[model samples]
Target: MNGDAVRVLTYNVRRDVASDGEFDWAARRDAVASTLRFHRPDVIGLQEPLAHQYADVRDALPAYEWVGQSRNADDGDGEFCPVGYRRDRFERVDAGTFWLSPTPEEPGSVGWDAAYPRIATWVRLEYRRSGERLLYANTHLDHESARARAEGAELLRERVQEQRENDEALVVGGDLNCLAGDEPHRALAGPDEESPLVDAREASPHPPHGPSTTRTDFEGLLPDRQIDHVFVAGCDVAGYGVAADVMGDGWFPSDHLPVVVDLEL
Candidate 1:
């Protein structure tokens, strides 16, 4: 990559109230911070972070600046799919959040048969040294609604295409809640790798390490459902993998493992 490589990581940190038993936010927050510190991705996107969890990460990783609010509202207390980037390495010139529904501009709106509201947070990052712009879109699809997942995929694809029209490199990360054989995954990736867009894991030059599973329930063992992913366009995938590391006492950083991808833009 000749020093043009950039690392991106996507994680669903598992909200505050939902974490069961020993996996409480207090017990795992530092482990999450340590994971971020160990990998040191240039850009990171997080999903399902409660207000206090967000505050903890923001405080722990002061080197990065972030933008995002709850999917529910601008000033509400709910899950957030926040995106953060290294301030010394890139400048976040612009960013915004939109619901993944028929009325995308309306916050807290639900689409189709979605059980709950879904949202996508996007940002424009200008690489400090290269001066090239990158568009990063982070989202969480409805976990229970097939129709909502499919339709939300189409909506996000349109947004990515709109930004692609400007010729900026694109990276989409999320807890898609759809698997490899699912139609929604196909919709985002088109027919295959021959299509314009490609899944980072599929395009990686180096084989991804660890199990394919990303949802762990914070037990430290990788499960079999690999619903989370990073999709890329206009960039070369240098490497991709599922991070399976854990902190002391068999504690996982989150219920869902973070997916990491290296790109040469």
Candidate 2:
């Protein structure tokens, strides 16, 4: 019998605070919603989602239920690294949030020369059709701190290994802020690391055929680095690509196009 297939999208919906000029959140919110509605991924890992952005997208796609909190931890005030899953396809079994700092249990914490507070959100999902469970971890690494990124990779590696110890399927996706071959990427991709995580783009049988750059400067230029990624540990990767859709007054949905991957679980 064939295993169930799941579609995933990792997106950094540009925060509203930034002075985005013509491509502000207000202008692109609908386009982003429209894009999600069209894609309808079974699972979505999102970064930099301000509170309102989350609400707007949730309103647009009611079929999805999300679990996440701001990295700040006081409330849903700061940027969020959230995961959303289709309600009809999977059931949330467990969930939690951890700051990407020395004090991982604490909120709004910084680590290893990090400029901003960062955190990761994770959930355990049970596929209803097959009764198979998987661990999904979503995070956004610091943009400026190389040490934080590398250290954060180790932290996530531990999480992935934990899932492996349990013999569970797992996926990690988000905006790492470091491109392919960077220190953080190297740390996560190390073949010698405890059960090295495979890049979904590289593992996908279909291969990456679209733009390589996920972080475009709102101009859709081929960036020097493809910072956004989806890493998997226990699944059959089917397809992967950078979702680059130009809409809404000729501007794309987000500054960073989403990284979408299909997996057989």
Model 2, C-alpha of 228: deviation from truth (Å): 0.3
- Per-model TM-score on C-alpha atoms: 0.95, 0.95
Tens digits of per-residue lDDT for model 1 on 1-265?
3466899999998887643767788878999999998998999999999889999999999999999988884556688999999998899888998899999988889889998889999999999998888899999999999999999988898877876646678999999998975877887887754335788999987789778899886765656799998988888899999998877767678889889999998
Worst 10 residues of 1 by lDDT: 188-197
Candidate 1's displacement at residue 29, Å, is 0.9
- The alpha-carbon RMSD values of the candidates against the true structure, listed in the order shown, are 1.8, 1.7
Question: What do the candidate models score in CA lDDT, each in turn?
Answer: 0.87, 0.84
Clashing residue pairs for model 1: none
Superposition error at 152 for model 2 (Å): 1.0
